[model samples]
Target: MLIRKAHSGDAQRVFDIRNQAINHQCVGHYPEADLAVWTRGELSDYFIEVVANTGHVAVIDNQVTASGLLDLETGQVDAVFVDPACMGRGIGRRMMDYLEQQALQAGLSHLILDSTLNAADFYRRCGFVGERIAQYQSPRGLTLACVPMIKHLAR
Candidate 1:
């Protein structure tokens, strides 16, 4: 697998992967209505800007299999999604590792994120710590439950 910075053209694929991951992996963890609301919509201009800026994609066999976003200035991991078909292959972990490395290189001392219910354990295993429930206000105007997690980077 090769991890590289995402370009604007990668926005659609990244959006697709986000939807697929949420639809398949988040079943039972979220209400169907909430899931529908969360995943609704096409790739927005905001997402395109993000892809061109803070995004990174994991490519396997010439296909984008996972994507993540790291805001260096804020030490915030805004997004991390692996295609449902590619789940359990350690792609997400690799993506996280790459994002963390980028954050460390940017002189960040910690990283923060709001993880979906289905992914809280994964984030925990990745060394993030948090269990208190939080509400993530989606850009699409949906409110969803999440776990606010943080990881202090080892210098």
Candidate 2:
């Protein structure tokens, strides 16, 4: 799998991956109402902007199977998602590694993310600490329960 910076053309695939992951993997973790609200949207313009800026995609066999983003200024990692069909293949780990490396290269000493309930353990395995319950205010105006996690990067 090749992990590379995302471009505008990757927006749709990234969006699809995110929704698919959430819809499939988050079933027992989130209420159905929350899931419906969260997944009720098409490819968003904000996603396009993110892809053009801080986004990255993991491609295998020329297909985008995962996506991630790192906000350099805020040391915030966001939008990390893998297609449900492509899970359990270490794609998520690779994406996290890529994002963390980008953060380190930008001189960030720590990174934070609001992880979905289903993804908290995965982030813990990635060396992030903190499982304080948090409410993530989505851009679409949803208040979703999430785990606020942080990791101090090794220099």
Candidate 3:
């Protein structure tokens, strides 16, 4: 597996992985209506631009299997997703590890993120703890439950 910064051209691949994970992996945790709203245009062209500017992706044998983003200014991790087919392969952990390293290098002492309900446990295992910060609402007012979490890094 290769982990590296994402480029603009890689946005579509990243978007696809996000959708696959949401569709296949999150169905049990969310309503089909909510899932439809969440995946539809949630990963947009503008989002791709942001990922290209501030995200990382994991590639296995030339295919993007996972993606994440770290915002240096806010010390926040964002948009983390692994392909459903690649689940249980430690790809998410690896992506988080890489993001944390990048945050530390940028002199951040902590990292924050809002995780989908389905993924809160994964963040907990990675040493983040917090609570349901807010209900993320789409433009149309559709909601996806999320937990706000934070992790303090050791100096």
Predicted model with the maximum TM-score: 1
lDDT of 1 by residue, 6-106 (tens): 99999999999999988998899999998899899888998899988999999999999999999989989977999988889999999999999999999
What overall lDDT, based on C-alpha atoms, would model 2 receive against the true structure? 0.92
Once superposed on the true structure, which residue ranges of model 1 sit more than 4 Å away at CA?
A: none
Ranking by TM-score: 1, 2, 3
Any runs in candidate 3 off by more than 4 Å, and if so which? 139-141
Which 10-residue window of candidate 2 scores lowest in summed lDDT?
Answer: 38-47
lDDT of all predictions:
0.93, 0.92, 0.87
Best by lDDT: 1
Cα RMSD, each candidate: 0.7, 0.9, 1.7
Compared with the true structure, model 2 gives a TM-score of: 0.97
| lDDT tens digits, residue span 1-155, model 2 | 99999999999999888889889999998889988998897887877998879999999999999999889999999989999898999999999999999999999999999999889999999999986898999887888889999999999
Model 3: clashing residue pairs? Answer: none
Shift of residue 145 alpha carbon in model 3, Å: 1.6
Tens digits of lDDT, candidate 3, 22-105: 898788888999888777865567887888889899999999899998898898898799998889999999999899999889
